[model samples]
Target: MLAFIKRLLIGRPLKSAELGEQKINKTKALAILSSDALSSVAYGPEQILIVLITVGMAAFWYSIPIAIGVLFLLTALILSYRQIIYAYPHGGGAYVVSKTNLGVNPGLVAGGSLLVDYILTVAVSVSAGTDAITSAFPTLHDFNVEIAIMFVVFLTLLNLRGVTESASILAYPVYLFVLALFILIAVGIYNILTGEVPQTLHTPIGTPVAGISLFILLRAFASGSSALTGVEAISNAIPNFKQPAPVNAARTLMMMGGLLAILFSGIVTLAYFYGIVPKAEVTVVSQIAEETFGRNFMYFFIQGTTALILILAANTGYSAFPLLAVNLAKDKFIPRMFLVRGDRLGYSNGIIILGLASILLIVAFHAETEHLIPLYAVGVFVPFTLSQTGMMLKWLREKPDGWVPKFVINTTGALISFIVTMMFFLTKFSQVWSILIFLPIIVLIFHRIKKHYDAVGDQLRLTTCERSPDIKGNVMILPVAGITHVVENSLKYAKSLNPDQIIAVYVAFEREDERKFEEKWEKWQPDIRLVTLHSHYRSILGPLTKFVDTVAHKAKEGDYQVTVVIPQFIPKKGWHNILHNQSSLLIRAYLLYKRDIVITTVPYHLKK
Candidate 1:
C-alpha cells in the first residue's frame, strides 16, 4: 500500500536498457496510436444498431443519424485531446493531464477512469472480434466467451514477453488492417457510384418512431460516441514515441485521427447505404457483403479483414494498460506491484492484472456486444469528460495571448463534452449506473491513499537520531541465505548493529548443502551459534515463518535478547530471482509482528 505512492517522478518510471530506449519509428508510433481508433470503427457503428434494437429493429436505420452525430463528437474529441498531447508530451496520459491542471483529486479520477477504460478497450475489441469470428464460422457460435477469454490470456502472454516484443508482433496486423479498411471503403464506394448496389438489400419494415424523441436520439448518440474512447491513449503514450516528442506525437495524432475519421465515416455511410443491419442472427458487415457479392471472394475477405482488425485493436489496450497502471501505482491509488518491470522493460504485473480483469468482463458478459457496451462506454466517457474538463481548467488558468486558437478549441471542446457526459449518464443510466458506483469508491480510495502518504511523510520527517528509537535492548533478526562465506560475512555486520545476540539460522533443503555448511561451521570455529532445521516443503517462506516465530518468542527472555542474522541477495531482473530471498521477507514480517524482536537484513552481492 505504501509502496504505491512513493514515486521518484524525476526519472523514467522504469529504467530501460539501451534496447528498450530504442527510438520508435514514425510509422510504428502512428500504427500504435491509430490502431485503437481504427479498430473501433468496425464496432462503433454496430453499437448504434445494438442500442436501437432495444427500441426494436423497425427503427434500425435511425442509427444513421446517430452515427453522423457521433462523428462530430469524435472529431471534437480528437481536437480536444490533441491539446492534451501538446500540453504534456512527457506521457503518463490522463493522470498527467488531471494532475497538471485540475487538482490531484480530478487527476486521480482521470487515472482511475482511464485504467478501467483501458481494460474495457481490450474487452470490447476482443469481444467484438469474437463476434466477427463467430459469424464467419457458425460452428464457433456458442464459444464466444471461451474464445474471448483465451484471446485475452494469449494477449497477456504476448504483453508479458514485453513492450517491444508485443509491438513488433502487432505491427503487421495493424498495417494489414489499415490497408484492408481502405480497400473495403474504396471498393464499397466504387460499387455504389458505379450503379452496382447489392441485389439482395433487405428493406426495413418501419422506423421505430417516424419522429424520434430527443431522449431516444441522445441514447443513440451515447452508444455511437464510444468510438472516440481510444484516442486519449495517444496523448498519454507520447513518451513512448521517438524524441522531439511534441511534433512527432502531434503528427501521429493527426494521421491517426484523420485516417480514422475518414474510414469511420466511410464505413458508417457504407453500412447505411447498403442497408446493413446488425442482427444477433447475422452480423451487419457480413450481411452487407453477402448481399452485394453473393458469398464470393469479397465477402470472406471482408469478414477476415474485419475480424483481424478488431483483434489488433484489442492489442492497443494490452500495450497501453501496463503503462497506465505504472502511473496509477506511482500515484498510490493501486498497489505498488505495478512499479516492477518484467525482463523486456514491460509491466508484467499490469499486463496480468489487465488480462484478468478483461477476462472477467468477457466471462461475466459472455462477450455479448450489447451487454458489454454499456459498461465499456461508461468507463471511457468518465475519463474523457474528466480530461477535457482538466484541459479547460488549464486553458483558463494559463490563457496565453498567442495561443488563443488552442484555448478556443479546447474550451469549446470541453463545453460540448461536458454536456455530452451529462446526457450519456441520463440516456444510459439504467445500463451504466454500475459505473457511477465505482466512481465514489475510486475517490474514497484516493483520499485514503493521500492520507496514508501524508502520514508516512510526517513520520519520516524526524532527525536521524530521532528516526530510530534508541531503546537500550533493541534486538535485530536477519534471515540468512545459507550461501558460502555469507555467515562469516554477516557476523561482522550483526555485531556492528549493537544487538545483544545474533543467531545464524539455516534450513536444510539439500542434504549436501547442510553437510557442507555443517563441516564449514565446525572448521571455521565461528563464535556465533548456528541453528539448522530440516524441512520437507519446497517453498522456503512457510518453514522460515515458523522458525522466526519460535525465535521471536524466545527473544523476550530477560537480558539475553535474540537477534537472527539473515542474508539477502537482491536481483535486478525478475527471472533472476532464484527463490527471491523469500525466507528473509517472511522471517522479517513474522519477527516485526512479535514484540522485542527486530528483523534486519545482512546484504550479500553475488558476482556480477
Candidate 2:
C-alpha cells in the first residue's frame, strides 16, 4: 500500500537506462536553469529601493545607478561562467573549478557557499512570489509564510519526479513571464517617451529621514546584488543539458544574462520614473504594473505570471544543489546517501533537504523578502569570486590559445566579485554575520568528514597478508520471552547451525514469573538447557547482555564463538507488531558490535 502511494506521488520507478531521456534541450533548460535569475527581477530592483528608502524617499533615485552596478557585475559573471562551462563541462561549477585550481579547502568553501545560496534561492524566491500574490489579493497578506512554504513543498515533489518532467511543467509559465515583463517594459518606455505617466498608487515623499552616504549606497548596492544570485546555476548544471552540453548551456547562459539585464534595468528605471515606493503590501513591480497598465487584464496578468515564475525559480536551486551535493559526496566530504538516486533518477535526498531548509527559512523570517535578501547574495558572490579566480589561475597555468583575453576577463570578474563580496559582508554584516560564522564551521565539518572517510577506506583496504579467521565451532543463545511458536521455530533454526551448545535464556522480574516459566520449560522437555536470570530491578537487556558477554568470554577460550538467535514475531497486520514487546530487537541492538558474538533474527509468521 505504501509502495503504491509512493508510485503515485513520485511516478513509477524509472530504469537507469532512462537517464538519457531526462536530459533537457535549450528551451526547457532555459526555463529550468534560469528561472531563479529571471524571476529575481521581481524583487531585486525593489531590494535596492527598500534599502535606499530608509534614508528618505528622495534617495529612491539611487536605485537605477545601483541596478546598473549590479548589471555590470552580472555581465562579468555571465561571461566568466560561459568560459567555466567549456572548461569544466562535467559540471561541479564553482566547487569543481575552485577545487581543481585553488585547492581542496577553497573548493569546499565554494561548494558550501553555493549550497547555502541554493537554499536561500528557494526561500527568497517563494517568499517574494508570495508577496506578489498578496499584492494582487491583499486578503492573503497574513498567510504569506504558509503560501511560501506550500510552493516549496510543491516544487520539491515536482523536482523529485525527474528533470525533464519538471522542465516541461515549468517552461511555459517562464516564457509567459518573460513576454509579460517585456511587454510591460516596452509599454512603460513608450509612455515615458511620449511624456508623462501618472503615478496613482502612492506619491513619492521628499522628506529626508536620514542623510545619504557612501556606506548607505554600498548597502543598497549589496541588497540589489540579489539580481546576480542565480547566474552561476547554468554553469553548475552543464551536464543537465542535451547533446553539446557546454555549447547549449553557454548559449542558455548568454540568453539568460541578456534577458535579466533588460528586465532588471527596465524595471528599476520605471520604478524611478513612476515613483514606486517599496510598500509592505504592494511590491515595486506590482506598483509599476498598475501604473503602466493600471489594474486591468494586463496588470493582473503580470501579477499572476510574476507569482508563478518566482515560485518556479526554485527549480534552479533544485537543479544545482543536488548536483553539487553529489560531487561533494563523491569526494567524500558529505554522506554517501546523497550519491544514491531516487526511483525517478532525481537526487531525492538533496531535493527533500533543500525543500525543508527553504521552508524553515520562510517560517523563521515570516516569508519577508527584505529580511531574507541580505543573507542572499553573499553566498553566491563568494562562489562567484572563487570561480573567476580559479579560472584566472587555470588560464595562467595552461596559457592556452587566447589565454590573455580569458585571463583578463576572469581577473576583472574576480576583482569586481571580490569587491562586491566584501561589500556584502561589511555593509550587511549584522544580518550576514551568521553565514560568515557558519561557513568556516561547514568547511571544518567537510574536512572532518573527509578524514573519517579516509580512515575508513584505509581500514577496509585489502592486504596480501590478511586471512579469514577459522571457526572451530559456535554456540547458539536464544533469549525467549515465553513458551510461544516463535521460540519453538527459533530453536529449530538454531539446531540447523550444528552448534557446540544451545542455551535458552530468560530474564524474570519476579519470583512467581520465574517459577512459572521454569515449570513450562520442564514440561516441554526440550533438549536445550534453560538459563533463568532473576532481576528484582526489572532490567532485561542489561542482565541478558551481561550474561551473553560471560558466555562469549568462555567460548573464546574454547576456540569457538557465540551466536544469538532472536525470534521475531510477524504479525498478520503491519501495525499489530507495535502491540507486542520488541525484546528481540533490543537484544540485537545491545550486542550488535561485540567482537566475539554474532546476532541473527529468525522470523515466525503467525497464521491468524
Candidate 3:
C-alpha cells in the first residue's frame, strides 16, 4: 500500500537505463536551475530598501547605488562560475574546487556552507512566496507559515519524481514569471517615458528608525547581495544538462545572470521612481505592481506569478543539495545513505531531509522574509569566496591559456565575495552569529563522519595473513514462553543443529506457574532437558540473558559456540500483533549482537 502511494505520488519507478533520457535541455534547465536566481529579483531589491528605509524615506534613494554594487558583484560571480563550468565539468562546485586546490578542511567548510545555504534557499524562497500570496489576499496572512510548509512538501514530492518530470512541471511557471516581470518592467518604463508617475499603494513611513551612515549603506548593500545567491547553482549542476554539459550550463548561467540583472535593476528603478515603500502586510514588489497596473487583474497576475516563481525557486535547492550530498557521501564525509538514489533515480533521502529542514526554519521564523534574510546570504558567500579563490589558485598553479585574465577575474570575484561575507558578519552578526558558529561545527562533524567510515572500512577489510575461526561444535538454547506449536517448531530446528547440548529455558513469574510448566514439560518427556527460571521481579529478558551468559561462559571452555533460538508466533492479521507481549522480539534485540552467541527466530504462522 505504501509503495502504491509512493508510485502514485512520484509516478512509477524509472529504469536506470533511462538516466540519460532525464538529462534536461537548456530551456528546461534554465527554468529548473535558474529559478532561484531569477526569483531573487522579486525580493532582492526590496531587501535593500527594507534595510535602507530604516533611516527614513530619504534613504530610499540609496537602493539604486546598493543595487548597482550588487550587480557588479553578480557580474564577477557569473564570469567566475563560467570558468568553473569549463574547468570542473563534472560539477561538485565549491566543495570540489576548494578541496582540490586548497585542501580537505577547506573543502568540507565549503560543503557545509553550501548545505546550509541550500536549506535556507528553500526556507527563504517559500517564505517569500507565501508573503506574495498574503499580499494578494491579506486574510490568508495568518497561515503564511503553514502555506510555506505546504509548498515545501509539494516541491519535495515533485523533485522525487526525477529531474525530467520536475523540470517539465516547473518550466512553464518560471517562464511565465519572467514574462510577467518583463511586461511590468516595459509598462513601468513606458509610464516613465510618457511622464505618468504611479502612486504608492502603501502609507509612507515618515519617522526614521535609524540614522543614515556608511554602516547603513553597507548594511543595505549586504542585504541586497542576496540577489547573487543562486548564481553558483548553475556551476554546481553542470552534469544535469544535456550533451556538452559544461557549454550548455555556461550559456544558461549567462542568460540567467542577464535576466536577473535586468529584472532586479528595473524593479529597483521603478520602486525608486514610483516611491514604493514596503508595508508590513504588502511587499514592495506588490506595491509596485498595484501602482503600475492598479488593483486589477494584471496586479493579481503579477502576484500569482511572483508567488509561483518564489515557491518554485526551491526547486533549485532540491536539484543542487542532493547532488552536493552525493559528492560528500562518496568522500565518506557524510552517511553513505545519501549516495543511494530512489527508484526514480533521484536522491530521495536528501530531498526529504531538505524538505523537513526547510519546514523547521519556516516554522521557527514564522515565515517572515525579513527574519530569514539575515541568515540567507552568509552561507552563499562562504562558498562563493572559496570557489573563486580555488579557481584563482588553479589558474596560478596550472597556468592554463590566458591564465592572467582568468586569475584576475577570479581574484576580483573572490575579493568581492570575501568583502560581502565580512559585511554580513559585521552588519547582521547579532542575528547571524549562529550560522558563523555552525559552519566550523559542521566541518568538524564532516571529519568525524569520515573518520568513522574509515574505521569501519579498516575493521571490515580482510588481510592475507588472517584466517577464519574454526567452530568445532554448536551449543543451542531455545527460550520457550509456554508449551505450544511455536515452541515445538523451535525445538525441532534446534535438534536438527545436532549441537553439544540443547536447553529449553522458560521464565515464570509465579511459583504455581513454574510448577505447571515443568509438569507439562515432564509429561511431554522429550529427549531435551528443561530449565525453568523463577523471577521475583517478573522480568523475562533479564533472567533469560543471564542464563545465556552463564551457558556461553561454560561452552567457551569446550570451544563450543552458543546459539539462542526464540519461538515467536506470526499473527494472521496485522492489527492482531498488538495482542501479543512481543517478548521474543525483545530477546532477539538484546542477544543479536553478543559475541559467541547467535540468535535465531522460529515463527509459526497462524491462520485467521
* Residue-wise C-alpha lDDT for candidate 1, range 144-245, written one tens digit per residue: 888888888777777665555567777787877777667777888889888787634523434346545677767777777777778877777776677787
Candidate 2 lDDT for residue 507 = 95
Instruction: lDDT for model 1, please.
Output: 0.72
Work out the TM-score per prediction: 0.77, 0.96, 0.96
Worst 10 residues of 2 by lDDT: 200-209
CA lDDT scores, all candidates in order: 0.72, 0.90, 0.89
lDDT of 3 at 410: 97
Model 2 TM-score relative to the real fold? 0.96
lDDT of 2 by residue, 113-169 (tens): 999999999998899899899999999899998899889989999999999999999
Considering only N, C-alpha and C atoms within 3 Å, which residue pairs clash in candidate 1? 59-208, 93-236, 477-598, 478-564, 478-565, 478-566, 479-566, 479-567, 480-566, 480-567
Q: List where candidate 3 sits over 4 angstroms from the true fold.
A: 198-211, 464-468
lDDT of 1 at 582: 62
lDDT of 2 at 544: 90
Candidate 2 Cα deviation (angstroms), residue 502? 0.9
Root-mean-square deviation of each candidate, in angstroms? 7.9, 2.4, 2.7
Candidate 3 lDDT by residue in tens digits, 4-62 = 99879999988889889889999999999999999999888888888877876777877
